[model samples]
Target chain A: MTSPLQQKLKINGSSVVTANRTWDGIVVYRTAAKGWSADLAEAAIVRTPDEAKALLAEAVADDVGAIGPYIAPVQVDDTGKILPGNLREQIRRDGVTIDLPV
Target chain B: MYAYDEIDRTLVNERVSEFRDQVKRRLSGELTEDEFKMLRLQNGVYLQLHAYMFRVAIPYGTLASNQLRQLAHVARKYDRGYGHFTTRQNIQFNWIKLSDLPDALADLAEVGIHAMQTSGNNMRNVTSDQWAGVAPGEIEDPRIWSELIRQHTTLHPEFSFLPRKFKIAITASDHDRAAIKVHDIGLRLIKNEKGETGFEVLVGGGLGRTPFIGKTIKHFVHGRDLLSYIEAILRVYNQYGRRDNIYKARIKILVHELGIEKFSREVEEEWQQIRHSSLQIDDEVIEDIRSRFIYPSYEKLPHMPDELRQAAADPDFEAWRKNSVAAHKNPGYAIVTISLKPIGAPPGDATAEQMDALADLADKYSFGEIRVGHEQNLALPHVAKRDLPALWKALDKLGLATPNVNLITDIIACPGLDYCSLANARSIPIAQELTRRFANHELANLIGRLHINISGCINACGHHHVGHIGILGVEKNGEEVYQITIGGRADESAALGNLIGPGVKFHEVADVIEDIVEAYLALRERPDELFVDTVKRLGVEPFKERVYATR
Candidate 1:
């Protein structure tokens, strides 16, 4: 696939590609299977800049289902699990930060 | 409440159909995101941080019981079973789906409510005093003029595009509950020395990034020439208002750049030509609109009912009566304000169940009508004094019996970082924390008539600039920091708050406010003195000293 560098975002550390589903506006992360999933656990973690660029490219290429694809910082634990690095990303991953009526 | 006429119904239905087609084209990729953004915004669809939020106007904050029931139905069917009432007398659904927006609009249209002009740089929903007709010491009902302005501004070809969004508020009472001084245009109905009711027109007041108290351009404009005078002001702003920068595009900026004298002169020069045109309101038309808002049939009863007297002996009912009820024009009746700011719950939020119950209460106690106050509370404008005890019991069952009107806990907050895409910090959590800190009703009552407003960003969606205690959220080095302002009041003596000191961390905000309130308590001459009055008496220096003492 031809990589479009213009859509590339500045990345500092371990990250995952994320976008919002266009239909429902839910946050979704790119998975290792080259598809979007709502669950952050299924997100494909990239440790290096090149890996993040490739994942972002895959996310942007799937434009039919999502909007505003970008790489977001993630933290990896000793168990090799991923979590959003910042409060905004964490809130996005886990719906509203406060309690909301279901 | 003004019922939708045939023209209004046709216009709403047509707009919904147009939006439905636009959504279809956007989904099919026939239109780019840039092309669809404006169209969606005009339809009141905002793409926020988590999802789409849809804002529906409650025209002049008046709603029929059936109309409110329809809103509840829309919440249950399309959204997440709840809606957030906004400071601008509107209701917003936070978790709306882009795909379901068209269907939602159509459903809302069936009840004569729409989301038109709620977003975009157009005349937004005209807000007015929540207790428009019921409040005593009034010249006339402001909602009549609010509805007239709504009709004139709706889909007006000339003002559909302006330098920035415009807002207008009308208040007939001298108390000024509508925050008229902070609106783009404030119309106050006042009687002349000759007993003729006219409007004192104030212009160019707004709060976003640049806050200014509106200046009275015309001391009194005849009620007949109200529309022409407004049109003249809008024309001047349209021609000379800055369009280059979004931040400096409000009429307030124009009035600031060119002094109010020069701006008033220009508006006068423009009004000289159009003052006698068709825009001059006819007396008969005014009377026609007035006739529609006739008082509901009231029974001839004594001022104090026996049941109310007996309930006043009960401490619980007396507590509710102290905070939740207000004096009405009719001696036998009172205005009831329902608190939406329950402890630990988001301000202005109502579940579908709560909304339905409120509607049923309106049918039973009120005259099948409800009003949304600018403070994000619901009011039953005309409830008999005898029915208050039963109403309080019913509201208690629904967890809506919090008696904190104008108290420290009755906070006004905007959906900040949690939902809004443009927010720099979160407002809801701070409000919740402050509410928890002041959960004691006795302490809150001791602090009498304190208004705490929180905005997530500089946009001032929460009217923080005019709050008795204003908290603004800002981002510093990627972390949220809150700045506090003191002594802002939204009444007749409207004044902007003064920034006390440096920004505090989110965890310190509640403590800072507590210190400020404690200082006010210590300094007040008597218990009857309000916090705002105390701040006015003792300058911001004392409050600032107490707040930053620990820093």
Candidate 2:
């Protein structure tokens, strides 16, 4: 059985492009300014499948700094704020919710 | 511990430089991810779910206090404040940066530690009985042989890129503490009728998607020809082992397909040509290695100390002493297993402060020596019996004195979906929940010796295959489910667990285990019979019936 992550990729959703920085392996989101940012709040929001695909393509084109570019589902609140739409993405954005020693 | 010679130091430093260059090339995109993956893996750097995970080998499960302190330094300096020790007797840092791995490797080399062969399709760090030299029933120290194998397998040219990863375990005692039967090659040190030391070699035992107990390939192989015999087995495996299917590539599969009789004949034929070659180690070489592991200077003392007798009066100290201490070979000393599976904490994880504290305790109590057991606990092998109360208090201060060794709460779990990319579900949380459920010391003591092992996936890193009560996590319809197994044993009579019925949902797992234990409590013939013994005697039917019964 395939895992949720291994299922067919769907571009049709409110999404933000994400990838890991090549050297440091930190998760980064495609920002509205056409660059990668560590903060998900600064991520460029895409409402349509086409917009998600375009942002993912742009992230892929900027491969010099990142790897494994994919579009992750995010919620756009009434205030136009972005938050992870699922638990997995929330974990990726906020680095292991379990309490860990510093 | 074998002190690093000039040659070892030079080779380690050279490896650090090479890895640094490889990382630099990878960052510059001169090497693609596919090309760099093998290089990084060989150096024990794995790209996990969130970040790069760095693993360092604790060769033969032996470490000096200073070396452990150095590891703590790396944990605090290069990673988060804690590190997770793995079932392979290696420690891993979850959050490692690719850019800092070279420096980390360099720092590790400074303490005579290395990541080489910790991963990749090479012979991994040769493991042995954790109490190799100190165990009472030992015929010979297995660490010497493990060390010899480590030297031979390190960067071995011919076997470097085999069909799959190979693991070899050696044990000198009759008790199978090293889990030799489940390894690719299980070497048991034995003696012949002539009183000559030799090895009883078993081949092709492994746990993964397919679990099989190893079969005896050779009744005995003399110590001098051990390496050549092993090399022969590897040669036979490399030539015929499947490379097309990664699942069928392990030597265990090859032996299973070829049959042990035919496999033994083939290895015997191959060994005839190489038996007298330079690979045959001499008695002097063995003695040299053995000489390096001489016993630490122990002051002569009476067998029983008055302080220990007085301390045994306290129930808490007595409980801790009974569960944590083991009989050492020396009359006045004991082997103390420091449990890493604290209540509510992740199994096998030690904070940097805890690591430093243990190091201090090792120096004060043991002879500055620490051993990492396959069960994910650290051991001070040379602690004087008189110092038990002091050691217990010190351990209590560091939160390491959990007298739950071999109990239900002492779980062996892999870093599952939370960290490992290969995991289908989470293992740590399951272990945590079970530990929390059985947190009461008296309740756990009532349950008695129960090994509850959990694996995140079929890879079986948590050794669920051999647990008395095994929990394997699986993904079902995008949800986490757990499969339970019963009657598995990793001892002299090693056997794989029998699967109970369907997988249980995450929430129902702890309750299911509680039900099974409750049934055991009702069905057991005597208080002395262990959980594994009861399951073995009565079979999995009773437990299966109870587990799958209606609510």
TM-score, per-candidate, Cα-based:
0.95, 0.94
Which residue pairs overlap in candidate 2's backbone?
none
List each candidate's DockQ score.
0.51, 0.44
Q: What is the TM-score of chain A in candidate 2?
A: 0.83
Taking the tens digit of each residue's C-alpha lDDT, what string does model 1 give over B79-127?
Answer: 9999999999999998889899999999989989999879999999999
Specify the CAPRI tier of model 2.
acceptable
